[model samples]
Every structure is written in C-alpha cells, then in structure tokens.
Target chain A: MLSSNPIKKSLNWLGRQLFNQENPAAFFDPLVTPINPLWIRGFTPAQVQDIITETADTKTFVLKPSNRWSGFEAGQHVNLSVDIDGVRYTRTFSLSSTPARWAEDGTITLTIKRLPGGLVTNWMHDNLKAGTVLGLSKAFGDFLVPTSVEPLLFIAGGSGITPILSLLETLEKDHYRAPVALLYFVRTQADVIGAERLYALRQRWPAFNLQVVHSQEDSKPVYLGEQHLDTIPGIKARLCYLCGPKGLMDLASDLLGKYGISDDRIRVTFFSAPAPVFTGESGGLVTFSRSGKEVEADDGKALLELAETAKLNPKYGCRMGICHQCKCTKTSGTVVNSLTGKVSSPGEEQIQLCISVPQGPVTIEL
Target chain B: MIKLTNEQLDALAKDLDAIRDEALADLGERDAKYIRKILRLHRTLEVGGRVMMPFGFIPPVFVAAVASLGLAKILENMEIGHNVMHGQYDWMNDPALNSQTYEWDTVCTSDSWRRTHNYEHHTYTNIIGKDRDYGYAVLRLSDDQKWHPAHSLQFINYILLTVFFQWGVGLHELETEKLRSREIRLRDKLPLIKEFFQKGGRQAFKDYVFFPLLTLPVAPIVLLGNAGANLIRNLWASTVIFCGHFTEQAETFTEEECEGESKGHWYLRQISGSSNFTGGLWVHILSGHLSHQIEHHVFPDIPAHRYREMAPKVQAICEKYGITYNTGSFGRQYMTVLRKIAHYSLPDRVRLKLQAA
Candidate 1:
C-alpha cells in the first residue's frame, strides 16, 4: 500500500539509501518504540489498556490498537503476537467487542480461554499486564451476520460466545427488530463469559432472548438435541450461527441438517484447529537434502520435531504453526497441514516444519 | 601440554556440556534485550556517522565521523551480525535476527560466512589440512605447515590481510588455494564469484557511490570518511580474530589424530586449538564475545554474550581435567599471535635452533 503512493514510494526509496536498505519507519523503530511502543512498522502495535477476568480460566484483554490499525468487523478474528520469555508467539482470537466500540473509541477486546497446556494463552493469563505492547494482525474471518433481516438463532459453547456477543451487540446497535434467540452452552453458570454484558444487552433489546444450558450440571447435564431446537419458535425459518468446540459444532450441524435447514442457512466457526488425521500407514522416510540424512517419520509428528530427534538443528521458533520461522522448502512430498487439515501436492512447495506432517516419502531443503 | 586420560576427557566434556546447557537454559529476555540494545547502539552510531560525514571539512568532525562509523560497523559485524548468524539468538523469532537470512553490513555474504566460518572452521577447528582458517591458506602459523618461498614476506601478507580483511573474508569461500592448485576449476567458482560481486558491489555502492552522491559538493569528504571507517573495521576485526585462533599456545592437530574423534576428544581439540583474551565488558562486546573463544568453540550455537559468564566455569573444568585453557590480557594474546606469525615466517623453529647450536 505504501508503494502504491508515488510520494511515499519515492520517500521509501530515499529512506532505503539513508538507512542502509531499511525503510525509514522500521529504521527508526528503536527510537520511536521507546517513546511510543505502538509506533512500529510491518505489524499494528496495540497497548493492553485493561485486563478483566471473565471466569476462573478466561481473561479479557482490552486493547487500544494504534491509530494506523484498520477497524475489524464484529465477528472477525485477529492474530495477536506477544513476546514471552524473549520469544515472540502469535495466537489468533476473535474480537469480542462491537465494531462501533472500536470506531467510537480506538479500543477492542479479545476474550481468551486458558487451556490446560496452552502456551500463549496460559502465558497471557499469568504474565500479560496493562500497558504491555503487542503486535496485531489485521482482522480476518467470514463468521459475520448475513445481509438478510431474518430471525437469528445463535448457538455458542463456552468461549465461543465471544464472537456471538460481538454480533448480538452489533445487531442491537443497528436496531434489528427481528426475533433473535441464543442457546449458550457452558459447563456451569460461573463458566459464562461476558455474562453481565449479555444480560445487559437482553434487558435493552426486546427482540432478543437468552438461554443458558448447563452441560455439566450435577442433576441433569443438558446437551443440544431435537428437544432444544424444537423449543425455539420458527427454528427452521431462522438462520443459525454456530461457534464452539468441534464436537458441539458437529452435533449442532447434524441436528440442524435433520431439521430441513440447508447448509447455506448455517454458519459455523471453529475456535481451534482440528486434530490432523494420521493413519498407521501415513508416515514414510523423510530425507533432508542438505544434510543427506534420511529419517523415518512417525505418523503425526511435525518435521521440526523429527529433525531435532535426528540430531539436526533446524532453525525453529515458537514450535507452533503461528510463526513461520521453521518453514522450509519441501522439494518433494505429500504433507498435511496440522492446523487446517489441508494436503499438499506431491511437488515443490514451502511448508512450515512445525505444522506439517509428512504423508509419504519426502525430500526437503533443510 | 598435558595428556588427558580418556576418562578425564569424558568428565571434562560433561563439565563443559553442563556449562553450555546451563547457559542455554538461562537464555530468555536477557539475551534478547542484550542483542536489541547492541543493535540500537550500532544504528545510532551509524546514523550519527552518516550525518556527520558531510561536515568533514572540520578535521575533528572528520575523525569523529570515521570513528563512530567504524565502531558501528564493528558492532554490526561482531556483536550483532556474527552472533546472530551463529544461531545464537535464534529463539527470539525476530526476522531481523534470524540466522538463516540475516545479511550483515559487510562485503561477506551471510550464506558464505555460514558455510566457511560456522561449518568448516568450527567443525574442523585447527585440523591442519581441514580447517583453512588455521592460516586462512596464506601465512603459515603452525610448524606443521611446510614452508613456501613466499613465507618470508608473510609479515607483509598478514598486514595486507588485515587492511583488506573484509575482502579476504568475502572471497574465502571461493577457495583460492584449491583454484591455484588446479584441484578445482575456476568454472566451479563462478557461482561463488557472482555472489561475492553482487554482495561486494552493493556494499561498495552504498558507502562509496550512493552516500557520496547524496552529499554532492562534499562528496569526496563523505567518500573518504566511509573508506576510513571500513579500513578501521577491517583492521579491528582481523586483529581480534587472529588473536583468537593464531596465538602461540594454540595447537594444531593432524587429520589422522582427529579421525572419528569422540565427543570428549573433540572437546579437547577445541580447547587446545582455540585461545581466549581477558577484557572488560566493552572490549568483549566489541570482539563479539570472541574474547571468550574457548567457550565459543565448545558451544558455537549458544548466545555469545553468555560466554563471559561461562568462561570461569570452563577454566575451572580445564584445571580439573589437567587441560590447558589459554587466556590472557588482550594485548598479551595479540602479541603472542604476532610472535607466532613472525616466528613461522622462517623454516622449522627446531631446525633453526639446531643450526644455531
């Protein structure tokens, strides 16, 4: 975009000469970041304006992004980069605040659920504080409200309520009078995220209805079924938005499908990558071309781990798929992306060693 | 020199490995912050030098500009570029510091440096025929090397190497020795030569052409200032590197002796072949912490800044193992390097002494 503008392009060229090929904005980052951490280039910088505990294991980060940051749609997700123990780790989270909030006051919020062994999420809960700077990617995702003004059915499980909360608020701000019902599934009432905000929205909006289902209730744990869908009025007519764990999404989609609801009428968003499928016959010999080392790869282990086990010190960082630090040229291979479950063609391609599982005999440039 | 028992060598290896592991485990925000601080300092000096170069009509300004610029280049090549390219701070995940892709502000490309320095020199160490870094295939610094007729003027060759140190380093991967012996054809060097020219050309254009042209009327002043800075950086780098590897006490091993070397024996070879110089914090930083060359040789991929703290532990381990840990003041080590250079300029020292008797 900077290059698209002639004046900026010329200035960039001049800056390259003055700063030994580094652009002026990036070259001055050391001086600028000390004054204002948000003044960095390449990525939008945000300051943690506040940290609010939503539940025992979930926290909400109120972020004030730099003015250079473009606002996000209500249900869009953003990749947030935080430097923990000197290593920069990036993890994506859905924006749980209304776009109107960001437009009015340059602040957005990401509600994160801490998993038992989640690296970045646990680090954020334990160490991140107000005033710490973070790198942010532009918002992306299509889990947005459809253009039509039909009645809406929202089914969210646990932290999946994050994006749903943003959509509900945005719909309320737009004064949508259509009937809207939310079936929020949580382990318990205390596990609810943004409970007060949801209650407040329901109190203000007459067309909205909220239901809390305790899936882990001692007396009777409730799971989504035909009985639940039958209770909502005009369920088949209303467009449904589903955001939750994989099992919940699969169940909800199946039930909706049986109810004569077309796939076009259902929107599903996954909060995390699905587990990559690996059969017993999946793995094969992996050849590191540079080192001339041949290793037998296990079914589901990433190339990076295999390299390390074979005494090859492949360059890596953030041992997760978020950082492309361990990407290498796959000269020949059929590999599967652990994050997206996408299979690569058996030819030359670049793949992230951290996330790719070799499907067959492969050769890679180490 | 003391001959370490195999058992003692194993214990020594364990001790040094423990030191390396301890330092590695302790790597975190401190190492990242240290590198960032050095980078900032380097950029500040570079920017300051470039800005002051046009005002070089004032003699003092000219000197100050050159000094700052030279220090900046030294910091970039040593403390920042050299360490980063060693995969020292690879955990940082910053693209600027990524070892595989980081290109320093020098004539030598990072790729070539990784192959020639990190791989060949580090892996083979001071093995007589294996590590060209022993004498850089020029001056004979060890008695094991056969003397050539050209050995007489090696003192001059050493000086020339120092003055144009960057070029020498940039062209090292070309294997001029192999080319001379016709072991390798010039055609095989085409790719390397192309890389050298592209990287070297860009470096030349930046300091000599672009910056000078930008300053127009004061072009010559800017040009001269840049050249002066480069000369200073070359001289400083060459002197520090020579002291680290060519001091009198540093031993050279024949390939036969190092065959299929075990981990303990490898550690022994590294300690025997490398030297260290004691200096203050600034001196260590300016040398890219190569002042702790022994620690570096033992753990080449670990962050160089940690070498200072690891030094005493390493020395103690050496004492316990009855192995030599060659270290002294920077001046003392450098003088010994000079002495070795001068002494090796003649034929075998033992033969000369016998002739004198």
Candidate 2:
C-alpha cells in the first residue's frame, strides 16, 4: 500500500536524490545515533530492558524494539547481532515471549544458551547489560501453532523450549480448550529454563499437560524411548512440533513415523546450522546458483579464481581476501578459509570468495 | 632507483609485515570509537550547514554555511569514504561503513571506485601502463610515458584538474583516452556512460537543484554557497592526494620488471613508488592519514588512523635497508609536486636537472 502511494514514492525519490543515500533516515542517522542508538536505520535497533538468568549458562534478554519494528508471531525466531571487540557477530534465537507481550509493553525476550566456543552467545552472557543496544532482524520461522484447535503435542530439548514457551503462553491467553501436551527435556532440574513458568502454566491451564523429563537423573542418563511416546494421550491424532538438538529431533521423527504420524504432521526446527564433517580433500562441483552453471573445481584455488576461470565476472577486490568486496553467499557445502584456516559449516554463509577454498562440492550465489 | 639486494629486500619485507600485523592486532574498541567520532562530526557539520542555508541572506551566515559544508564534504570524502572503501574497517561489520556497498556523497559510484581504486590501482600501484592511477591516464607524471606537445600545458592542466578533481575522479573509469584512441568501443561503454551520468546527475541535483530550490527567496545565495563548498572540498582533496604520490622523490616502476616479483620485491616497489608528508593530527585527519602514504601502501587494508603509529617503524625499516624514505613537511612536499609537474611538462631533451627532493 505504501509503495503504491504516489506522494510517498515521489518523496522517496526526492530523498534519494537529495541525500545520495538509500533513504533520508540513513543520511541523518549518524547525527542522532549518539543520542539514541535506536535512531539507526536499515536494521531495527532494540534496547535491553532487563536480563534474567535462566540457568548457569543461559539468560533471558528482555528487549524493547523500536516502534518501526513489525511484530512477529508467537513461535517465531529472530537473528540478534552484537558488537564484540569492535566486530559485529550474529546468532539466531527463538522469541521466548508472546506477541501480546510486545504489543502491550513494546518488549520481547530471547532465551539463549552458551555454546562451548560460540562467539556471540558468550559475548551476550558476559557483556550485554540493561541499557546495551543490539541490532535485530524481523522475526522469521515456520514453527507456528496450528490455527485448528486440535490436540497438539510439543517436544523441546535444552534451550529449544524457548518458542514452545511463547506458544503455550499464547494458547492460554486465547483460552483454547483443546488438549495439549509438552514434553520438555533437560539434563537436570537446575538446567531447566523457565521452570517456574512451566509449572505455573500446568497449574492454571486444565488441558495443558507439562512433563519435565530429566535425562540425566542421578548421573545415569535415561534417554527418550518408546515409553515416553506411548504414554502421551492421543499420540496418533495430535499434530507434533519439535525443537532440539539434531540427534533428539531425528530420534523423535523416527519414533513418530513408526507410530503412524505422517511426515507432514511432524514439524521440526533447528536452532543453529549443523557443523559439516570435512574430508580434507579438494575438488567439488561448484554451482553458481544465479547463472545455473556448474564448474568442476579440481585444484585448491580460491572460489573467486575458479569463478573467473569459468568466465563469470563476480565483483571482487584485493583478490588476497583483505577487502570484503569479494564476499558472496555460499548456499551449501563446506569450505576452508585460507587466511584463518577455519572450516565453515555446510549451510548458507557469507564468505569472502578470495579466501574460501571448497573442501568438496560447494554452491555459491555469485 | 632502489639498490637493495635480495637478502636486504627479504628483511625489509619481514619488518614491514610485522608492523602491519602489530597494527591489525591492536585494532579493537579504540579504532571503532575513533571512526565513529569522525562520522558524527561530519554529520554535525553537514546538518548545521544545511540548517543555516535558509538564512544565507546574511553575509557571515553565508560564509559559515559554505565553510561548514566544505569541511563536512572533505571529512566525508577523505576520512570516511576513501578509507572505508579501502576496506580498512570491514571488521566493524557496520553496514554504513561496509566497503562493498557504501555509496559516498560524491558522484563516483562505489562499484566503479572499488574496481578502479581498490582492485586495479592498489593492486598494481605505480607500475606504468598497469596502474592507471599513476597519473589517472591524463597528465604525464613520469618519463616512462611518451612526451607529447599536448603535455607542454600539463602545468595548467594540473591546476584545472585539481579544481574539478571529483569530476575527474568520477570520469576516470571511462578510460576517455582509450575511447579517443578507439581501443574501446563506444557501444561497449554505453552501460558505464549511463552509470556515470546517473551518479553524477544525482550529485548535481542534490547540491544544485534540490537544496537551493528548497530555500525559496534565498535560492541564489544557497546555490552559490553550495558551489563554493564543493570547490573547497575539491581543492582540499586534490591537494592532499597530490602530495601523497606526486612528490619528486617517488619512483616509477616498469611492468616487465615486476613480473613474477617476490614478496620482498613487492614491498620494495611499494616503498619506492609512494611518498609521505609530515603533519599534526588535524592535518592527518583532513588528509585521511594519506600523508603517511608509504605505510598505507604497505598495508592498504589496515585502518588508516593507524598509519601514524606505523610510519616510524616503516621509516626505520627503510633506513636499515638503505632505502630512501620519501618524506618532508607538507609545504616542502607539495612544492616538489608542483615543480615535478612543471618540469615534466617539457620535452626530456630540454629538461633541467632538478635537485633531488
């Protein structure tokens, strides 16, 4: 609607001409940014209003996004970016608070758990405070509650309980009378995030069944099995939503398939990109997604050279990797960074084409 | 001409590489804060100037408006635009400061700049017929270029070039000389020509049309102020850049001699091809730290602000290798540049032996 409006369109064109920028806000952002970091354009800026320690390694960050931010659905995820040691790093996290909460108080929460070597999550835990501002992308994820008020089953592990908490809160607010069961998995009771809120919801909502399953009870870990699936009421009829580590998700999908639940009925969400195992070999069928061209790369040359050799003139500068002018999206396959010698995960990632050498077959959006 | 042996060149390379690494390692909060402060200052001046434009009927106010706008343009073009486009602060990961996508307030598109200045120029720095930036394919700086009767007025041409420096830089990628020689077809250059017009047209509209028209009865004064501001920025930017590389002591290299060059030899070439000038903090900032052009040539991707700390170490390495570290006061260096332009304007047969700079 805004795009079709003639006055707004002409104003946008005039702004572009006058400012020599993408928009007027960008041209003026630097002037007012020091007064309030939220004055920034392009990305939505959010201020940390509060922080709650959920576990030893996990914390819930309560953020108040600027009014320009379009709110999200209850069970969606957003990418949070933080500046660490002057370099910006980003990581994805599920919104732990419901949309109604944001509408009422202009605030949302993201529950994060620290990864062993994770740069962003660790920085958030150690450095982020009540007044720190961070960059946020709009919420995105298909892990949403079904509108049909049918029996629903939720399976969450570790920090994966985040989106599920938002879904549960929304369901209760809407007073949905349909049956619901949540099998929340954690290593131990101390590690259970939002423990009090889960128990509170179980007591207040009659149809909500909350099961806190401790996998590592008394140091003898008991994993998910058929007994857990068989005990859930109406397992065949209820639609399933899963969020967890890859191992748990695969196991759950396998058990649900065996129980006659179709693949379409079982939806799952992965919190982070799965790390790829490298064979330490060279040569891959490099696909340029845009051009639909395939190149058989044999030697251990950077992708930029290979692209140019195939007569594809991808934008590049400082061919040795210093200038990020050559950075492009590698949609799939692992690559080793020549400068830092770090292996990349086999998923979509921004990489400097001048430094990235494919470990095997890799696809890039040139 | 450089006389360093292979062993000496290797040691020089090691020393320069160590200096670059040390500066890069020290880049963190301090570097980020410094750049952000400059960005804020630039924005403040620009906003203040625009706000004052409507009241330009007053003589003092008009002068202040022009000066404010000029300083802002200089800061943006040199300190922020030039250095950021060099990929100096790519580690910051700020979208506005990103080298790949940042569009400066100038007429030249960032894409064209990245190709011409970053890739072609910086990579092949000062190698005749390779780095077009040697004299921007215009004035003949070194004797390597063939002398022509047209070069007789290159002294006057240099003055005109400085006054309209931004336009000259914006049109540098068109390879106008190649176009004249019919080496590149006009049909092939249609897309580039369109890009230049679009970018340059927007800049003209902004400074010449939009802002002036918005000021109603004070339109003429506002227009004059904007033109004056652009002139100041162009002259300042041109002078600072000329001092960086055009000093008499700077050497020119042959592309054939650079074939299969080792890392040490590459380092030697960079030092020989560039010159530096001494200045205080404000001068350094106004020049975008390009006054330390020798250190910048060694590590172009490193943050420009760090060049001050890196210069002494680079000079020490040059001294150790018996290399001439070309540096002098700003006035002295700029004088040598003017002398070189005048001296080179004549045929080599009639040229006088100027004292070593």
Candidate 3:
C-alpha cells in the first residue's frame, strides 16, 4: 500500500483518455447534471442547489458547480451567466461563502440584491430556482484580508455584506486572534442579510462585535458618521474594510480620512458602478451598419443598452465604463460618454458602447 | 417593376432599413430557441446516423443510415455551422457559438470561409468582376462577363462543381485563378496551401480512414455509405447555394455602377443581386436559410432563423418602394437558375432573346 501504484495510475489515465476524448469536462457534467443534464458545453456549468431569501429584495443562491471548478478565495468574485428568455446575460458577483464551506460541501453562495428595472437581477430573482443550470467563470478579483493580525473593522451597507460575510466566516473558522467589529447598515431591521450568522459569530468569538444599524427606522436617517467611528475603540489603528453603495462608501472614506486612518489600511469593493448621468440628447435613429438595422434612440440610455433593447446582441464584458470590450465605431453623430461626461466630436470615432449615449442621429459599425 | 428616381430609391433604402430594425427588435425567445433546438437535433442525428452505418449488411438499413447521415451533414454544414460562423449568434456570448472561433465540420477551414464568403462574397455580392462567387471562377453567370471559349464547357463544369462543391469551397481562398495568372507568388500561396492540406487531410482521415477502419469486417460498406452521404450533402448544398445567387432574376452589377454607392444603392444592389425561394421550416433549414437570401444579404450578422420572420416585412417595404423582391417556389427557382446558367454559357449576341424573355 505504501508503494507507488503504477497500475492504478495507468488505468486511471486510460479510462480518462477513452471517456474524455471529446470533452475533458464531461466527467463533471454527470456530477452536477443529475437533475438537468442538458447543460451548455464550453463553459463551466453549475447547478443552483438552493435559493435562500436573505431580505425582501435580496436572495442568496447556493450553487453546486462541476468538479472542474477550482476552489475560489474567500473574497474573490465570479462571473455568472444566466439565460433568460433564451438570451444569455452575464454578471459578476462576489462569492459570499467561505472556502472551508466549499471544501466541505462543494457549494458556494452568491447574495444578489434585485435592482428595480434591471435586466439580469430582476430576471434572476423572478425566474432562477433549484436545479437550474448556470455558466460560471473561474474565480477572480484580489480583495483578500491582509496577513497582519491588527484589529479589523468591516463596514458593509445594504447588499454589500456578501464578501464581508465570507471574510468574517473564514476568520471565525480560523480562530483569528485579532479583535473584529462589523458595522452593517440597512434601510430597516428586516433588510439585514445574514443576521442569524452574524449573531452566531458574536456568540462564538469573544472579541467579535456586531452592530446592525436600522437607518430608516429612526426619525432621522442613521448614516455612518464620526459618532459611529468614535464608538469603536482604537478604530484608527484597525485595518478597515468597506463594501457598500457609492454614497455610503464616499461618506465612510471621508470620515476615515479625517480620523487619520492610513490609505493602505482601508480596502473597498464596489458592487456596481455609480448610476450614469443621462444628459445626452436622444430621440434620434441609431443605425447598425453591418446588420442594416436601425432603432429610435431613447434619451439618456447607453448604446449597449439600446442595442440590447433593439435585440441586436453587442458584445460587452463589464457593463461599467472600465472595460473597453464594447468599443464600436461611431460612423456619424455625437455620443456622450456617460462615465466621463465627455462628448465625442461628430464623424468617425471609436466609442465604448456601454458608456456612450447618442447625442443625435448615430450610425455605428457594429 | 416601376422605374424610380434616385431620391425615391434612397427612400426605399430607408424603408428597408426600418424593416431590419423592426425585425431585430422583435427577436425573442422563440428565435433563440429555434437555433438551439436545431443544433441539438443536428448533433443527435449525426450520432445516430454514424452509429447505424456499420449495420449496412441490411439493405434498408444501408439506405436509412446513409440518408440520415447525409441529412445530418447538410444540417451541420448549412443550418448550424454556416450560420454560427457568420457571427449570427456572436451576441449570445457562448464561446461555442462565437463566429470568430467556430470551426465547422468540413474540409474548408472556418478562417478561410470567413474571409472568402463573409468578407468577399457578402461585401461584393453579385458585382461581375468583384464577387468571386458570381461564377466561382468557372462559369459565365452574366452577359456582363466577357464570353470565353472555355465557357462553352460550363454545362459539364457546373455538374462537376456540384459533385465536388465542398472541395471547391475548401480551395476557394486559394484563388487558383490568380495562381494560374501568376498574380500570386508561390511563396504567398504557401501558408494558405498548408492550411488547406491540413484541414483536407483531417477530414479525409476521419471520413475515409478512421470511421471506416473502425467498422472492421464491414469496412467497405461503411466507407461506401460515408462517400454516398458526402455526395448527397455536396449536391444539396450546391443546389441550394446556386439557386439563391444565380437565378434569372438575379442581376450582376459593374464596379463603375457600384462606385459612390449610397445606402439606398447598396439596398438596391442586394435586392437585384439575390433571389429567394419559398419553403417550409425543414426546407429552409436544409437550404441553410438561404431561402431568404435577400434578407441574409442585407443582414449577414443577424441570426438566420429570423430571416423567415423578416422576409414578408422586407417584401412589404420593397412593394411600397416599387422594388421587385425576386422570390419563387423551390422548383421554380432551381429551374430558373439552371436556365440562366445554360443561357449565359454562349456568347451574348448568339443568345436567344426569346430565352432571355
């Protein structure tokens, strides 16, 4: 038994070569496709094991991915592809489950907050269910906890508690020696996500502290301010982690700066891009030259969104302005970049379809 | 068809563009589902057909197996592979469905086809000297083409082309005409020739060697069945493609005529240069949705399944603009194409006006 088993290894290789000739990932398909075997190939497929309602507008999706899924880091994000009405939509979400949990149960969780009038999120909330198959990209992003054992402060707002939850659970499981405090803000008490888990963590870890702020319940909105920072002892020395809406994160950053908390000590993750300003003149025809298709442009919407509405599938990676994957040639007319608030000169120029809204009649070489 | 002024033609182009936009906007789950289902069915049929080929000891089994395999190849080459490789489903963001990355199960490399068909044929359409696909360098499709002594043998050439259509498509990018004229140096042709051989060798090995050899004692039967299947697929593909592009009603434009072409002129050229055939869903799929050739010429990147829904809308726009939408039954279209090919083989003056009428 102690000797190297050459025969076993050879047989394993032979078996793999014979069965996995067409697809290397076919073995994993059987594992996850017990309920639905008709999974899309050439993509990492995962089955929705369960859906847990975290709040009124938020739900945590538990996924059991194929064996091809390499384990993800605690604070990493993964791109998920879901098909709604036969059209596939991709969105990135931070994995909220600990690596230990994934190792033990082979499951991960993504807490999604439904955005009103949003395409993917609304479709997911309304239609996604147990046994539904989804495509997943390998884990990415570098928002991990530092090696230092300095006391930690985690500030989470609304649905921003996802990655923080992962970090806390990992720390608690590892028996972290440092003191940790969490300030979770939501509109009301009912809006709190993972309340029971946070309570359990507080009971188990002696140095762990939890503060659930119900902002809407009070006569005046209870925004995190200097007063909140003063309550946490030695807050200036703590390694601060912030994940929240842009407005809340901005306020916290200002306060933390005033408190003399160093820049390196603060880590922030944005769940979504800030809402784009819709100042471009619309109600003009947007023509796709190659497809010979034209649609009336609605005021203040990015060309990518308009393309989607027109049922012309334009390639895009990150919906935010950062990714240049959605760049297209504007053959004529001006387009305003919603992210930078810069207007393009009329005539031929490359514009990011995801960020550029039509100023007037536009023709795009899509 | 009523003659129209330049301004009226421009209005027609605008109306046709509007139709395309409306068609795109109307695309929904049904359109996506159609292609997805066809892909699955094609795959299933291919597997089933291949599996049944070894049992060709039974005469009925041999015919059924060959027919099934032939149909599978047709569907794959036309409905699934060709459409997918056109960047039709690129918006789906499924890497498997991406046009740039899709490799079809044919001798022709996807890269070469994309350049030859997607860029050259589609961009130039039926322009006499510009579009290689007008006669595929072997036939005199229009009177605009200089009549040659070699074109007298076009009747036989057309038959041979149909028999080996896939190989013709495979070697299309080689531009053998240029090679004959020494327009391309041998060094320039090296990479393309290497790619062609690589793809051709792989296809031959699979169809003629690997699968046939796997059948052992029934190897001959399997090999013959495979050959028969390929022949059927080739003939059908040739018929569908030829009918779409070379019918009597289809016109060829000169480079001078197409120069300084506005959007309206482009639309006019596409309408006159392409012919459509009326068919059911199965027929449409078998034709690779080339039945709606006019719509396809206008919108090459849109999913081919949407062409059926778009055809009537485009026709209505054409009617409003007094532009002729050249469409007919499958038999009518094929006969017309064959008649045109025969009629155009002779010198222009010698051709009968009665036949032209």
Per-prediction DockQ comes to: 0.31, 0.56, 0.29
Q: By TM-score, who's the top model here? A: 2
Model 1: colliding residue pairs: none
Point out the higher-scoring one by TM-score: 1 or 3.
Answer: 1
Per-residue lDDT of B1-357 in model 3, one digit per residue for the tens? 245778987788678767765655566677677776776666666667789999998999999999988998898899888888666765455555656556777788877887778766776789887889988998888877788878877999999999999898999888888889999877887888998897787677767887889888999999999899999999999999998889988888889887877767777888888999998888998888999999888776578888887888888888887678999999999999888788878777777665657
Candidate 1 has an lDDT of 0.85
Clash pairs detected, candidate 2: none
Model 1 misplaced stretches (Cα beyond 4 Å): A1-7, A10-24, A147-152, A174-179, A203-207, A234-239, A260-266, A272-296, A299-366, B1-6, B349-351, B354-357
Model 2, residue A331: C-alpha shift (Å): 7.6
Q: Report the lDDT tens digits of candidate 3 across residue range A1-366.
A: 744588667655543332222343333332334445545345778889999999889999999998878889888899888876656666678899999999999999999988765667778899898988898889988778778788999999998899999999999888899889999999999999988888999999998989898889978888998778888999988999999998899999889999999787899987642222234456588999988888888878899998888788986654554224455767667788674466654544456788888977888987
Task: Give me the candidate number with maximum DockQ.
Answer: 2
Please give the lDDT score for candidate 2. Answer: 0.85
- In model 3, the runs with Cα more than 4 Å from the true position are A1-35, A38-40, A273-366, B1-3, B353-357
User: Which digits, one per residue and each the tens of the lDDT, describe model 2 over residues B1-357?
Assistant: 577777887788778877876776788889988998999899899989989977888889988999999999999998999898887887677777777777888888878888888888777888999888888777898888889999999988898888988899988889988999999988987887899999999999888888988876888888999999999999998888888778988988898988887778878888888899998899999888888888878888888998888888888888888889999999999998898888888888767444332
